[model samples]
Target: MIRETYVLVERELKKWVGRRGTFFISLITPIAWLALFGKSLNFVNMFSSAGLQGANPVIVKQYVDQTLLRLFGTTNYFAYLATGMFVVFAFFQSVFGGVNIVFEKRLGSMNRLRMTPAPRSSIFLAKMAATLVRTFFYETILLVIAVALGFSVDWNAINFIEAGAAIALLAAGFISIFEAIGFAVDNQEIMFSIVNLINLPLMFASPALFPLQQMPWWLRDIARFNPLTYAVDIVRYNLLGVHSFNILEDWAILIAITAVFVTAGLLASLRVLENY
Candidate 1:
């Protein structure tokens, strides 16, 4: 199984490397967010320009700190925003896990592989592993861009290790969910449609680009149940020295969610393969 999974991982990586343009384009979303949106997000400026008519500077300062900085735990909004981009990049990579399988099916590659002695589980594992590796590659690039744009991330070895683990687990869980969706649907268009339906809502509802406290009451309630919210909090706590939620509790929830999705994804992949 290890050998078979490794082979699949290699194949996936090769495909990613060959499509350099696609890989880079996928990365542009996070970079653009940090470069353009992060630097420009300022409610204070907007409020001031709206002419509150000589409001006390101290009151304005306090409002900014409490409303925005409190949510992010940072004066530098870029750092806060960049940290959330990890999940965004992870989601992008994971969303395509099963799409690869669909393409292989169309190309008859999957049929050829099933003719071999390779276990069906191995095929799915290989794709999962490949997605993980791909995510890491894109995430690293995004981090470099963030740092270049003056986003501060914690570099303490212990913190970095813990944060990396959290990221891996988050990616694993999301990848499994998407992979399951891909396997269950034969048509790539339908799979992508389902993905699109869920992706943007999940991103907006989570405290990724915006803080939870600033959202409407209903959106905040919805965010409470979003796994990406937990992912963002865990990563921010570890990497940005921000602890909006209990770190230990967040990790527990994230792990539990990952386990459920991974199990479902494995079962779905196996069932799909049996049919193929």
Candidate 2:
């Protein structure tokens, strides 16, 4: 199984490399977020002001010490925003990859592949792997830039490993959900439209730019229920060693969501292929 998976992954990687334009375009979103959005996210103090004012001075000091200042290992607000931007980029890549799948289906590539002797699971796994690799590539480039810009992180082996695993899991879950949508949709344009429509809202609804505790009560509740929130939280924890909840609980929720979404994607893709 491992060998077969590698073979399929290699094939997908070749295709990805061959499409230079597509690959460059994929980097644009992450670059824009890192360069543009990262600058605009300097309102962290404003966002946290209300919560800070309402809390006891000592408690506020502790919160700032534990979360914003100490947890991130830096007092720079941009570094904190960079962590959230990385998560957003990962989720966006996965969701956008689903549109590519829909395009491939419309182009009849999916049907041609289906008629081949290759295992169906191999194809699904290959797509997921591609999404993961692409996301990692884009995010790593952004991180390098962030580091160059003076964003300091704990350069430990454990943090690096955890960050990679967290990103992979988050990408897998997001791709799974979007792949299900691709299976259900018949048109590439419609799929693209739907994905873009949800993109901004998902970012805004999550704790991407600021902590959930800083949000209004209604928004905070909504963000708490968002899977992207968990991904952002875990990434922040891994990158900065600061967490909003128990580390074990965050990992469990992320793993569970990945499983559910992967299962749903497989069922949906299989049903659609079978009918085709």
Full-model lDDT for every candidate:
0.81, 0.78
Best by lDDT: 1
Candidate 1 RMSD to the correct structure:
2.2
Task: Residues 62-94, candidate 2: write the lDDT tens digits.
Answer: 555566564345466677788888888888888
Model 1 C-alpha lDDT per residue in residues 176-226, reported as the tens digit of each score: 877777767778888878888988999899888878888999999999888
Off by over 4 Å in 2: 1-4, 40-74
- Model 2: per-residue Cα lDDT at residue 218: 94
- Count of steric clashes across candidates, in order: 0, 0
TM-score of each: 0.91, 0.85
Q: What is the lDDT of residue 187 in candidate 1?
A: 84
What would the TM-score be for candidate 1 when compared with the true structure? Answer: 0.91
- N/CA/C clash count, model 2: 0
